[model samples]
Target: MSQLVVEWDRLNHEIEEMTALVGKKDAEMALLKAQLAKAQTEGPGTEEVKELRVKNAALLS
Candidate 1:
C-alpha cells in the first residue's frame, strides 16, 4: 500500500510538471504568433516597404 502511494505521488508530480511545461509552451507560441503578425504588418524588409510606398504613390498619381 505504501509503495502504491509512492508511485501515485510520483505520477502526480510528473503530470503537474508536464502541465506546467505545456502552459509555458502555449504562452511562448502565442507570443511568437503576435510577433509574426506585428512583423507582417510592419513590413519585414526595406524592399517590401519601398514597394508598398511606391504602390501607394502610383495609386495617388
Candidate 2:
C-alpha cells in the first residue's frame, strides 16, 4: 500500500543518515588513535628524566 511505501522510504532515509554519522565517527576515532600513538612515541623517556635531574642538581650547586 501507499502507506507502507511511505514508511519504508522514511526508514531508509533514517538508515542512510545514521550510516553517514557512523562513518564520520569511525574516521574521527582513527585520527584520535593515530595522534595518541604519535604522542606516546614522542614523549620523554627514563634516560631523559635522569639527565634532567642531574642538570637540575648541578644548577643548584
Candidate 3:
C-alpha cells in the first residue's frame, strides 16, 4: 500500500543518513589512530628529555 511505501522510504532515508554519519566517524577515527601512532613512535626522546636526564643524574650524584 501507499502507506507501507512511505514508511519504507522513511526508513531507507534514515538508514542512509546513519550510514553517512558512521562513515564520517570511521574516517575521523582512522585519522586519530594515525596521529596516536605517530605520537607514540616519536614521543619523549627529544633533546630536552636527554638534558633533563643528565641534570637529574648529576643532582643524584
Candidate 4:
C-alpha cells in the first residue's frame, strides 16, 4: 500500500542519516585515540596534562 511505502522510505532515510552520523563519530574517535597515543609517547607537560584531564572529563560526560 502507499502508506507502507511511505513508512519504508522514512525508515530508510532515518537509517541513512544514522549511518552518516556513525561514520563521523568513528572518525572523531580515531582522531582522539591518535591524540592520546601521541601525548603518551611525548610525555605530557603540566599544561598538556591539564588539557588531557579536561578532555577526559568531557569524554566521560
Candidate 5:
C-alpha cells in the first residue's frame, strides 16, 4: 500500500512538470507569431527592394 501511494505521487509530479513545460512552450510560440505579424506589417518588402535596385542602377548609369 505504501509503494502504491509513492508511485501515485511520482506520477502526479511528472504530470505537473509536463504541464508547466507545455505552458511555457505555448507562450513562446505566441510571442514568435506576434513578432512575425509585426514584421510583415512594418518592414521593407520585395517590391520596394526591386524599385530601389532599379533606381540605383539608373543613377549609376
Candidate 6:
C-alpha cells in the first residue's frame, strides 16, 4: 500500500541518519581512547598528556 511504502521510506531515511551519527561517534570514541592510551604511557607533564597527569596526581594526593 501507499502508506506502507511511505512508512518504509521514512524508516530507511532514519536508519541512514542514525548510521552516520553512529559512525561519527565511533570515530570520536576511537580518537579519545587513543589519546587516553598515549597519555597513560607518556607520563603526566608532557604536552600531549598534561591533563591526564594532573588528574591522576590530584587523585593520588
Best-to-worst ranking by TM-score: 5, 2, 3, 1, 4, 6
Better of 3 and 6 by TM-score: 3
> lDDT, candidate 4, residue 43?
85
- How high a TM-score does candidate 1 get? 0.71
Tell how far residue 30 is off in model 5, in angstroms. 0.2
**Per-model TM-score versus the true fold:** 0.71, 0.76, 0.75, 0.70, 0.85, 0.69
Candidate 5 lDDT by residue in tens digits, 1-61: 9999999999999999999999999999999999999999898899998999999999999
Model 4 backbone overlap count? 0
Report, for every candidate in turn, its global Cα lDDT versus the true structure: 0.95, 0.97, 0.96, 0.96, 0.98, 0.91
lDDT tens digits, residue span 1-61, model 1: 9999999999999999999999999999999999999988886588877999999999999
- After superposition, candidate 3 runs with Cα above 4 Å error: 45-61
lDDT of 2 by residue, 1-61 (tens): 9999999999999999999999999999999999999988998888998999999999999
Ten contiguous residues minimizing lDDT sum, candidate 5:
40-49
- The candidate that achieves the highest lDDT relative to the unseen native structure: 5
Cα lDDT tens digits for candidate 6, 1-61: 9999999999999999999999999999999999999978776556747777778999999
Superior by TM-score: candidate 3 or candidate 5: 5
> lDDT value for candidate 4?
0.96
Residue 36 lDDT in model 1? 94
What candidate 4 gets wrong by more than 4 Å, as runs, is 44-61
Question: Going through the candidates in order, what is the number of backbone clashes in each?
Answer: 0, 0, 0, 0, 0, 0
Query: Over the stretch 1-61, how does candidate 4's per-residue lDDT look in tens digits?
Result: 9999999999999999999999999999999999999978898688988999999999999
Lowest lDDT sum, 10 consecutive residues, model 3, at: 40-49
Q: Distance (Å) between predicted and true CA of 36, model 4?
A: 0.2
Residue-wise C-alpha lDDT for candidate 3, range 1-61, written one tens digit per residue: 9999999999999999999999999999999999999997888768879999999999999
Best by TM-score: 5
